[model samples]
Target: MAQAHHMRIGEVAERTGLSLRTIRYYGEVDLVVPSARSRGGYRLYTETDVDRLQLIKRMKPLGFSLDETRELLAAVDGLSADDTDEDERAALAERLDSFEAAIADRCVTLRRQLEMAEEFAERLRRRRAGRAASA
Candidate 1:
């Protein structure tokens, strides 16, 4: 198998459609810290960081607060076999389930909001049409 070269921060940002500032801010907050730094002092990210940043993007769209995002990322980071005890695996699974449910709830709320907006627009259109017909 061919080895993959490490990606610079800008490359990661371009690939993921995230701004460089956002990537740096995520690093500053210990969210998705870069894997390493280049000799020139630029941040270098690995494929793993790319994956994590994508998850963060998805979570934000699903209405996760930063705190929730942190917890979710922590849960994800704790998945190593070295980080687990025999008894803790189940607990970790439960925590992940909770995060998934929270995201699903946010999706439902967004759907409802979109439906409400569509209905409101329809009503306004009908009202405008009625007024124009009267004139």
Candidate 2:
């Protein structure tokens, strides 16, 4: 609501490390719509929207499904909004906690995958170096 400068789709893509197509697709899917439209009918985004896009980018690597992402965004938005109902706060808090646990689990899995990938790379490097030394 209170951004010093609005950003266009290209700026949003550059800042978020997301492709322009992906940002537009997110809008099409109702995942994260832009806050406003320019005089030229281009999409315009606020700082808050940029932060949301970054959150989506962070989630991408964790393999969250579209439904999961939608749910997470809903929970986050509810918590962040000013007029969240008293009854809904507790449930949103629980959802945030559950998401935290899920992300922790995913981190463990990703770490293991990274270790395996590093080992595979090391093996290839060793083989290549050994071949060059013998040549």
lDDT of each: 0.87, 0.93
Q: What clash pairs does model 1 have? A: none
Model 2 residue 135 distance off true place after TM-score fit, in angstroms: 5.0
- Least accurate 10 contiguous residues by lDDT in model 2: 1-10
For each candidate, what TM-score against the reference? Answer: 0.87, 0.89
Clashes of 1: 0
lDDT of 1: 0.87
Stretches of candidate 1 off by over 4 Å are 1-4, 81-83
Show the colliding residue pairs in model 2.
none
Q: Model 2: how far is 127 from its true place, Å? A: 3.2
